[model samples]
Target chain A: MIRFDNISKRYPEGRDALQGVSFHLPAGAMAFLTGHSGAGKSTLLKLIALLERATRGQLFLDGENLTRTGKRKVPLVRRKIGMIFQNYRLLFDRTVFDNVALPLVIAGHRHQDIARRVRAALDKVGLLDKERALPITLSGGEQQRVGIARAVVNKPPLLLADEPTGNLDPELSRDIMRLFEEFNRVGVTVLIASHDLDLIARMGHPQLRLHQGRLLNPEVLAPPQ
Target chain B: MRPPAALRVYFLRHVQVALNSLGRLYRAPLASLMTAAVIGIALALPSGLYILTDNLQRLGSQWDGGANLSLFLRHDVSIEQAEALREKLAQWPEIERLRLITPQEALAEFRQLSGFGDTLDILDENPLPAVLALKPAAEATRPEAAAALKQRLQALPQVELAQLDLQWVKRFNALVDIVQRAIWILSALLALAVLLITGNTIRLEIQNRREEIEITKLIGATGAFIRRPFLYSGLWYGFGGALLAALLLALAFVQLNAPVRELAGLYESSFRLHLLEPGQWLLLLLCGALLGLVGAWIAVSRHLATIEPG
Candidate 1:
């Protein structure tokens, strides 16, 4: 669950990355943040992840005021939100299993729990057989799948993917989108930031569009007025 | 969780990380050994100097001339009177033991030692007077008390002169003190060198792993988690260096042992270099490990804060 109340993030160089964007997505909702380049999609995701602070207004995620949450509590907040980047961001030296096990390890889960959860997540992403292989050995789509498995391994209540399929072909992109849909069916709130409007529109999920750093149509998605 | 339970888990994780760090080092043996070897040499110098000074001081203290009081009898005192005087002096609490040397016995020892045996035999009258060699109580190690006791011996009717033969002992004690101070200064400087070495190494490590660190932070790894491996690796470096230093010192001691013994024999001295005690060795190891930890900590605290996930 995320609620942004007129959040505006201004960079130090006097550029407004996001301008007064207001929206609320309730629990278990899946949506795409559709926008062009520099339309503040990544910035919005970053603000929600507490990677960047809003220059003005507030952000609330799962009942906690993220705008006011200090840096010390950022890690605890982030533990609840799984994140994926376009580049996969997987450690090249780590094996597939290790990348998937990263979140559980950070949470201090014991060996047995981490192993079991990591294997199940890998199985869901169809990467179980490549668990021992390093990220460098994997294909682009397979590496991105490893990133997906890692994001979901911890079973975080919320998932944020920034350009998850930006590097994949159309078919692989569809497969990646299907993986996200499977996660959403089990009730994890998912927000994806992407510029692939045609592909996202075919999925028929609710869309929150941004133009020139402004939420184009907050009225369509704001919960109950 | 209860505090004890939490602490136990925390320590277990730390131990795991420590071993993992060591494994990582083992994966790069040459680099790790080279770093540790430098640290080892730095540590070994001070440890060797400390042991050397310690042995010298021990040797000087064993035959402590400061504990001895020499009482020279008057020339008029007969051997019987000198024997009576020794008995009288031996009864005092200050005198632990006293041995009387009659003039005839003294003359014979002088003739043998002074290398003028034939010349001394031609003299009509032997010049050496009867003497009593007294070992004072343990309290006489204090120079003032020894001097007071010497004055008491000189006041005796049969005694012509009494003095403590501890001038060389005092000089040796001062020399040992100076050596100890110098060792401390050298140790301090070398400790700084070790700290800088470890700090620079950790800094370079953090730089090489910048991308890994950024990814870890992005995936919600806390600062403590990111720091654990580095700190443990630093400790391993220290631990390895300390072991190497101990090994080096032991080898040196073995090589020097026979020669030292031979030299002592030539001087007719009963002194031999004592091997390092267990406690001293433990302390050296601890010092090396602690220096490594501190160096790593300093580097991490300074650099890790600058690396934040974006």
Candidate 2:
């Protein structure tokens, strides 16, 4: 679903976040991206989400050349993408249902369809009961689940999560990882960026390791545990 | 054929979000009302001043009590000569009409109207002078032309002093013109003030919801969708302010209407003061709403571009 030919990103402040990075994740495939802090993992994910553009090279997202995409078309391109953040990034002032309903709302779905899909996504993440609760009132794990539900509510063909379980305990982290696997199993391409080498190794998905803005390894593709 | 399902979805979502934000405003009555009141006050002052200026302009133009000039002939001028001078002036193109009022004629008219007939008749000799009352031509009715005609009449050997009744009208016209200009300038400045106030309010709202905007952008919310609520907020602010201003003007009109009518009646004039016209009221509302929408749009475009979910 994503192909990058030596993508490089350099900020105006003389910081080179990524350089000579290239990778391809086939449709319906799932993979983990492991890198240290500032290892260009977030930058790569941003490139995929169209939040940040590659300074050099071409990127093909679902066979569409995103490198030539105009700013006005970015939002339309992002419709097929679901992005998650380490902070969960849920709107704290809103309830769980509202947070989960955001993607569908952004997609301009009808109210009934939005409600049904949001509930179903929340149920999938095991947080359907907490729909009316505020994000501030939820536990760290439950909040992350809410984020997951929000990400999947639109049923995006591509999912990108940056430290999805960053704040969760080991058990909750495993549960989050399992949720990702389940989505992947259902043919949604998933790419997760994390610094947790052990958890990623145990998950047994293919790994794309970034070191010093370079793709040191590509496509581990070990069978799932 | 049925309409596209996507289009139906979009319409429903728009209604939903717009009503949602409106409900949000209703839920927090005090703060919302405060903002609206500020907008209303800003709009009301200029509108009231403008309406006042309009009525004053009407009154000023209606002061055409006829630009009549009275010339007191020299004491020694005979009634026949005064009559001859009147006849000569009557034929002039500048003179609309001329009447010779002999001393006795003036005295008799004064006595009948002044209710002091006996007192005036007690005098041994008539003290009133022969007077020539003249109305200017249509083109000479303007203040400058009337003054020029008066100057020419004063140069006549038989004329003593020329009194132009249009002087007070000239002064009043000048005063009204100044007031109208001042009101227009005030309206422009206050309109700008309204724009800034609304823009600042929208900017602050965007700042408060920065995270939400960023998240929405990341979730593929289009530019129009993201801007919809803020635009509506501005519209509400403008509309609410306009209503408040209209209400204020109405109240002011009510309190002033009776006194104005009584004053006009005292002067034996039929002039009546009225509030803003119906068309004017609609225009004010439209201007307010338009300003609100523009202010919000500017703020959204400037700030929303900076917020990205990276």
Candidate 3:
């Protein structure tokens, strides 16, 4: 449900972050965006999220032209998508329950709906027992789960994860990937940006590779074993 | 599906967040009280000055009616001529009230009341001149108008000189003018101080919560949404400060009332300190809210933009 056609981005200081990149993903599709650091993977995700405008070329999310979208409408587009970060980005001052309930709160859900949905999302992340615990009291993996729960609480159509398991151990990272897979199986499109080629190989998903701001053909990468 | 309800709910949620912050302040009652007291004193300085100015103006207007000219007739002028002049002066619109005092009558009253009857018996001719005590109209009570009227009265052949009793009133008016100007300048300076205090407080709060804001932005929170709670916090500060100021001013007026009344009683007069009217209270509350909102807006707009999902 996202299309980036010949999109290019260049910083004001003469750095080309993305160069004539194009991609399309159908509804309910899942893919991994693989690249090394400074390989323009974040730039591609930001363009799709409308956090940054492309310097040239057109981009669309669910057939809505994002390249020409006004700044005021960017929030509308963002609300329909969820984002998970490697840092978890949980508010340490709040309980895990409030942290996961945030997206629904931002979407103006009723109090009953917020309570129900937050509980369900926390349940999905296996953090239902730690609902009242503050982020500072939770372990890193637990905090990341809270972030994942928050991302999916609003039931957004698309989920974008920027190195969601970057700080976790191999076992925890695999478990997190399984959580993402479960959501994808339930019809939520998921795009994850990562440098973990081994994890990609284990998952056997379609891979979109970026090198020096250019998209490499997915077919050239050996199929995940 | 309706947007207005959604927007209102959004705003209310932020308001809830703001209330929670205020709850934190309330939890530390003694510190909050001390801080509020300082803000109250800061706010009360200007409000007290404004009340003083208002009362001073009221007292001045009461005595504005006291301005008058005493027109003394020449010793050589006959009683009939003095009577004719008095009648002529009565026709002038500027003269609100007048009374004639013939020389013979003036001397008789002076001798009886002044305890100088033995000294007055040695005089062959009456020393006192016939006088017309003249009160001016309200519009003609200013120093310039009184001086002009004095000059006009002196030009009359029967009149020796017209003494305008405007010295005390002129001095009081000058003092009131200065006090009014000082009130304006002080209010402006104090308002600036209020803005700075609120702005700095909000800035510190933003710094403390920088992580929260960055996290919010990363999770798709809009700038407006992120800025909402801080704005409410500022508003709470302003509202509290203004309420404290109003209370302080009211207490001051209450404390000063008895002494002011006793002093007025010494002059056989009735005077009271004017309490803040309903409209003034509304203005104070509104001022507080606006100060809070503006200060928060400045702090949030400057710092929140620098934070991103890096």
Candidate 4:
């Protein structure tokens, strides 16, 4: 449920990061955002996340105008959205259980609720046995699973992943894609940004491609299997 | 779905997190003790100066009451003339207390007080003049009033010379003023030193924990959320430091109390050192907490902005 209407972003050094980009994805829909390096994929995601303001034009999330939202309200808006990073940004100093519990903690969940939800999310990632292990002790694939578990722990309506499997092997990448599909099947809107065309093609999801800071084409919905 | 009492839950959670950070401090007792000790020493310098000033003020107030002026009659004046002059001077509204000493009584007092009673027995005639000791009202104890009164007494026909005993009081007041100004300057310098010490500590902590902070931000943790624990840690440092400083000051006062009491006894007076009042303790605690909070805030604000999530 995000809409970017002719949004453009220009850095102070006169470099255009995003130029006249526009797109819309409906509620509970899953799509893959693809572009080459410096093609403005991150800029588009940043605009939607309200981490960066657009230089021109309006952007909306779930029908609320993000372009007009003040700085103080950004945190509240972000609380409703979950983000997973390519680096698997687990807190190395904390246990796997604590890493997954972070989103719920930020959402101010009760202790009991947080424990229950975190355990369930960890179970979903098949890491229930390693709950007490630190991220540094985990394999790369396991760390990514921790990131995924954290993203879904809050049960947010929207999930954004920036190159979720960019650092994973082919087998692990497929497994992570399956994890995203499972969440999408349960009605979470998911948008993943990546340069992995083959992976997107294999997943057979709708594609929104970006080229030189502009949306290159309308949504190319996958044909029926 | 909105929870019925989410804000209370959130506040409790924040407190829990703060306590958890405090627990970490407790886990490393030696490091915690050293940090707190440094903070205590920084706090103690000013606090000790304040106590000293307070005690000096009390001593000054006690001595202020004993200030008096002595007027000696001329050698040719008779006892009856000196008595009449004393009675007339006692009528002045500024005079609080007065005593007339005849030449014979003055000579006797000098012999007893100066420890020359045996030697004075051999003298044929008394050399001391009739003396009038006058204690002025509190408002009239200023240097100007005492000088004017001395001039008036000296002009009397029955008087040889009038001497004001206010010189000691003036010197004591001057010393007290210098001590007070020194205390103010010392407190100001020590406060600045405390701020710098706390700031440097927080800066080092930031450098050490840079990776953890970057990771937290990358996971969408708000700056406030990431900064909360560090703030609490700073608060703990301040609180612990102030408590130690207070204890150290109290111990010092305890150590000095006996000697001070003995010295006062030598002068046939009872003097007791004053401990810190409740208000002073509260002020110390407040100062510590504020310093910790400010130091941590400055450190976090300066370094947190430079970290970017890749």
TM-scores, all models, native as reference: 0.90, 0.81, 0.82, 0.80
lDDT value, residue B48 of candidate 4: 89
Superposed model 4: Cα runs more than 4 Å off: A219-225, B1-7, B27-32, B62-66, B69-164, B214-223, B254-269, B272-274, B308-310
User: DockQ (C-alpha) of model 4?
Assistant: 0.39
The i-RMS of candidate 1 is: 1.2
How well does candidate 4 match the true structure in TM-score terms? Answer: 0.80
Best by lDDT: 1
Instruction: Compose the digit string of candidate 3's lDDT tens values, residues A1-225.
Output: 887778899988889999988778777988999888999988888888877789999888988999888877777788778898888888887899999988877667888889999999999999999999999988889999999999999998999999999999988999999999999999999999998889878898888899989888744423223
Query: Which candidate do you rate higher for TM-score, 2 or 3?
Result: 3
List clashing residue pairs in candidate 4.
none
Interface RMSD for all numbered candidates: 1.2, 1.3, 2.0, 2.6
Name the runs in model 2 displaced over 4 angstroms.
A219-225, B1-12, B61-171, B268-271
**Tens-digit lDDT track for model 2 on B43-102?**
999889888878876775455445678999999999889989988998889988788889
| Candidate 4 structure quality by residue, lDDT tens digits, A1-225 | 888777899977887988877777778999999999788888778777776789998888988999899866766677667788888877787899998998777666799999999999999999999999999999899999999898889888889998989999988998999999999999999999998889899888888888888777854532222
Q: After superposition, how far is residue A39 of candidate 2 from its true place, in Å?
A: 1.3
lDDT of each: 0.89, 0.86, 0.84, 0.82
DockQ of 1: 0.66
Error of 1 at A186 (Å): 0.5
Q: Highest DockQ, which number?
A: 1
**Which is the leading candidate under TM-score?**
1
**CAPRI quality of model 2:** medium
- Model 2 chain A poorest 10 in a row by lDDT: A216-225
